[model samples]
Target: MARVYSIVSGKGGTGKTSSAINLAAALNSLGEDVIVVDANISTPNVGIHLGAPIVPVTLNHVLTNRAEVTEAIYKHESGLKILPSSLSTQDLGRIKHENLVQVVKQLKRLSKYIILDSAAGLGKETEASILASDEVIIVTQPEMPAVTDALKAVKLCEQLGKPVKGFILTRHRWKKSEMQVENILDMLEIPAVGLIPEDKNMQKALMLKSPIVNSYPKSKASKAYFETARRLLGIKEEKGFFERIFGS
Candidate 1:
């Protein structure tokens, strides 16, 4: 059975969607079958990020019973599968959020990893995504506001009886002004799963509408994402200098 991981964040602009896409790509690179689902119905971006912003069939159709779940799935150029939600505002209300769990169950039967890129904040859509997943990977920046929101998300997941896999710290600069990894863990009480460095290549990849791992495999952010994937898969590997210093 495939494991479903809802990649969520407390607030917007936390690189949650980016982390979800890259992590799916990294797993696919390892010869694992992966599917990325845009559960962020209000602001779906998985298709946009993969250069297939508009498709005939989408998650909205599946949820509304207009199309089968399999029909909504499209294979990306990078060999990963994506089930993107409709970008149209009209389709938003058509979706029944309560069906998310069943939709995820169907998806899990089709791939090794089913990554649901959830919407930001603690809204109804986000809660449904959380309940539909096996576990959650909270994404946040290493700052006071982001960390505070991450803690709220973690607590929400706990109350819902959803296991939190860990936290992914994105756009990490390791600057003196930023909150240290230790402090973040101490505050959130969740182990650090990964740390994505701020890289211009990530922006370029976004412009190109491809995952950083595929567009610039040698970039720092790509390496971090790959490392995060490997760690999540429980694959043992040697730690690099940055990991030794920052402790991923």
Candidate 2:
């Protein structure tokens, strides 16, 4: 079975989907068969980040027994396959627990890495996504609320006996920024894996519906994501100038 890694966050708009897309792209660049599963069925947008439109089939169709999971995946020329969500009529929708488990089992046999782009907040679906994964990347910003909420998610992961591989500090600006990162990690007792700087290129990439790694490979944000991917696969240790500034 393939190792699944879920990219999750506690609050909305903390760059969880961005991290998920870029990390999956980076893994593909390394010649790994990466499948990005847009598990955020309610508000799916990974396809937009990848510059791909919503495919005909999605997780919703598969979960509803309308299509096979394998048939719903869209293969990219970049070597990344994306399983986007059905953006049609998700009003008051919920993924059944049994179907979620079966979906994970089905994905395990199809790819080298199943990167689940989970939704914001601590919902039932978020909990199930984390529980199904062997490792998780909790993306957060430098703000207090983001850290506090992430701790709550960490506690949930602990309750489910899931291992949090590390935390990724997103939207960080200066090298000396995010002074609270170390405190957050110390309080949660989780390792710090990445610190992605705030870059305008990221926004431009999003607006253009292209991944930073693919659109601007030499950009700082892209390089940071590549390093994060390296750390995720144990190919390299965490190294960043901000670590010295934040003492993390």
Candidate 3:
């Protein structure tokens, strides 16, 4: 069965896109067929992150009746297939809300996991995307505004009948401990999947158009992503305490 997840943030620059791309790669590395659907049609970055060429066909093509969903999908060498959005400014606000749900239903049969990279802010498309997802991964930074927006998103997801699977904190400096994270979770009432500290290699990896998991597997950010994937899959037999500490 295909599990559909929506990765969203209350605000932009919360590393939501980065989280989606890296998590998708980690899941694929673990032998799961993953398709990352870049629903952030207005500002799609998955293609740029994965180093895939911007093509003529994309999610906009499918929604606009210019191409089939299958025809818009590009298979990356990293073993992750992507259904990217068009770069045309003309299609920025042209997405049909009804068609969004239809498109997701069509994609469910195509992969073991469908990770939707939603645009920041609560809009028609964002709401519909979350509503269609079975679970949500709310990404936040260790700041007040991001935390506020994340809380609103969590509430909205609950109202839409979508269970928030967990939260993921990114761009953290580790200056604060898990207590700060726990407080935010207490407000949103959701457990965290993991934390990804900010790293310079992330930008370098982005420039290279490859995920850290594949480009620099031993990096702290890469190891964090691996642990997040393991938790998401509920893999038993946890890693050694010292191994986890040393890796972090």
Could you say which candidate leads in TM-score? 1
lDDT of 1 by residue, 73-169 (tens): 9998999899999989997766799898999899888998999999988999999999999999999998999999999999999999999999999
Candidate 1 at residue 129, lDDT? 94
All candidates: TM-score: 0.97, 0.91, 0.92
What is residue 16's positional error in candidate 2, in angstroms? 0.4
lDDT of 3 by residue, 183-209 (tens): 776776787786888889999999889
**Per-model root-mean-square deviation over C-alphas:** 1.4, 2.3, 3.1
Models sorted by lDDT, best on top = 1, 3, 2
Candidate 2 C-alpha lDDT tens digits along 59-159: 88888888898888998767788998877766326556347668888888988899999988889778878977888889988888898888888888988
Worst 10 residues of 3 by lDDT: 239-248
Question: What lDDT, from 0 to 1, does candidate 1 have?
Answer: 0.91
Clashes of 3: 0
